[model samples]
Target: MDNDIKNFFKEIRKLDDNIDIPAFEEINIKRNSPRKEYYALVGIAASFLIVFSLFFTDEKVQTETNDTDYVITLSDENTTNTESLILEESSIYSWEAPSESLINNFND
Candidate 1:
């Protein structure tokens, strides 16, 4: 088996030596459109305009003042007629675990 494998590899190596491989070629990629540069300049100009408007603009805000007064008057007779509220008792609920005897009765 070893001799057969060695003979197979020798044949493969002889075939590999006879095969021709291609040579490497240098490729140069260049941009053919100037729209990318124009877009970038436009974006930069827009950012600068926004920054200048936020920092250099001077605008005054005017607020109006209201001097009107509001007065509410309550009658003494209406204040004296107040009624009391009555509440009824409600039942309370409690939680308890099952006793050992109950568990044993169920198991039986």
Candidate 2:
């Protein structure tokens, strides 16, 4: 088995070395390297489009419903404020009334 392996390796080493693999490989590498520049250009274009959309795409987006005055409600009738109600209650209870409350409601 050892002798068979050595013979196979010696036979493989006898192959022609005049074939130039370097030039073909150099051309392939150069051709593939230029794709990096194309990729960079595409990246820049995509970034610019994203930025432009964020800033300029919607200057004034008038939604279909802009007439919603939802925060404030207006009424024509006058409503009683807390201060005025307290004042009125105080004035009513301040009068001298008969001591009918002294009689218990449980009696006749």
Candidate 3:
């Protein structure tokens, strides 16, 4: 590996002995100036528009008034006794469990 590296460098030195290299040139460019006042003017205009809209906007609230009165009575001229309208215990049927036929209909 040492001999191979020495031979490589010797060949590179023999090839580079007659070659002439050129020097690098400097580039001249002019940069444009930044527009700081235009950016500040746009920001001030946006802030002024936001503040102006907040001051000029209006919100109206609506209110309604109900002046009518409602009267509720329990006993009139026709309804004299309330005992005839009472319900009995046997007249109200109790709840029971579902039958087997009713449960089988939902399985389909």
Which lDDT values do the candidates have, in the order given? 0.69, 0.68, 0.67
Q: Which stretches of candidate 3 lie over 4 Å from their true place?
A: 1-34, 58-108
Residue-pair clashes per prediction, in order, are 0, 0, 0
Candidate 2 or 1, higher lDDT: 1
Find the candidate with the highest lDDT and give its number: 1
True-structure RMSD, every candidate: 22.0, 9.4, 18.5
Question: Between prediction 1 and prediction 3, which has the larger TM-score?
Answer: 1
For TM-score, the strongest prediction is 1
Per-residue lDDT tens digits of candidate 1, residues 1-108?
A: 699999999999999998876544434456646998899899999999998776655321111122233446576766677667666555455534559679989999
Candidate 2, clashing residue pairs? Answer: none
Say which prediction, candidate 1 or candidate 2, comes out ahead on TM-score: 1
lDDT value, residue 17 of candidate 1: 90
Error of 2 at 63 (Å): 10
lDDT of 2: 0.68
Clashes of 2: 0
